[model samples]
Target: MQTNMFKRLKRTTRTALGFACLLIGIVFILLPGPAVIFIPLGLALLSLEYDWAKVWLKKSQKYFRQAAVKADQALHWFGKKLRN
Candidate 1:
């Protein structure tokens, strides 16, 4: 019983901290600082306990990768056109 309570308390604390970080990150997005940085970090922490967060994390990663690829392609095209 004692051990179980301690485990439960620890889990709750982790969840609370993760949630707080997620909210703060969201707020920071509209205010200032590197919001993109915090969002992934929050998702990472929340992923530890929530399936929804895990799904979002994967989606965010995929989106960022796609954006990066597009940016690279655009840069290459721009450079080629400049050379021509």
Candidate 2:
């Protein structure tokens, strides 16, 4: 019973924190803060206990990585063109 109580507490805490982060992130979306960073972090935290969040986190990571790679490639190409 003690272990069960502890488990429930842990789960509840995690869920509360995750939702808090996500909600703050949403509010920040319209403000002048870092919503993009917070939202992903929230999802990442939630992903610890949720499969749907895991999938979303994976997709977000992949998209960001691809964008970074594309930006790098574009910069490299631009540099090459400038050199020529």
Candidate 3:
């Protein structure tokens, strides 16, 4: 019985965290903040509860990583040009 209670508590905590992440992601979308980061984080939290969310999180992570790489490359190119 105690074990069951602990399991229930853990589940509830995850649910709450997932919902909070989702809400934060939405807010970030409307505001001028880290929407890209928050949206992926929210999807990751939701992935704990749903398979579809897991897929979305994976894709989002990939896209974000690609964007980061591109941005880094652009910055490097800009720095080289500036030095020249």
Candidate 4:
């Protein structure tokens, strides 16, 4: 029916957009753009329709969290050193 056709169209559009963002993110990785943002955004969008993207998105989230913790620690340590 029309509903099924609409669903298919929506899925196709989402997939195309997700892949476009993902590819742009990959390119940005080497060109000094916002790869970090776009990559997760793409994964998030793709995850809405794909299990594989969901897995990868989870892993990326974990890695970003760890990186944030490390960066925060480094900043605190640096601030303490400056005070001494």
Using lDDT, give the best candidate's number: 4
The segments of candidate 1 whose C-alpha lies over 4 angstroms from its true place after superposition are 71-84
What is the alpha-carbon lDDT for the whole of candidate 1?
0.85
The sequence of per-residue lDDT tens digits that candidate 1 reaches over residues 1-84 is 999999888778777877887788789978987667777787887898889999999998898789889999999999999999
| TM-score of each model, paired residue for residue | 0.71, 0.73, 0.76, 0.93
- The candidate with the higher lDDT, 2 or 3, is 2
lDDT of 3 by residue, 1-84 (tens): 999999888878877787788778889879888888678777877787779889988898898899999999999999999999
Question: Against the correct fold, how does model 1 do in TM-score?
Answer: 0.71
- lDDT digits (tens) for residues 9-34 of candidate 2: 99888878887888888899899898
Model 3 residue 64 CA deviation (Å) reads: 0.3
Q: List all candidate RMSDs to the true structure.
A: 2.4, 2.5, 2.0, 1.0
Task: Estimate the lDDT of model 4.
Answer: 0.95
Segments in model 2 whose C-alpha atoms lie over 4 Å from true places? 69-84
5-52, model 4: which lDDT tens digit per residue?
999999999999999999999999899999989899999989999999
Query: Candidate 3: misplaced stretches above 4 Å?
Result: none
Global lDDT of each candidate: 0.85, 0.87, 0.84, 0.95
Name the TM-score of candidate 2.
Answer: 0.73
Q: Which candidate should be chosen as best, given TM-score against the real structure?
A: 4
Which residue pairs of candidate 4 clash? none
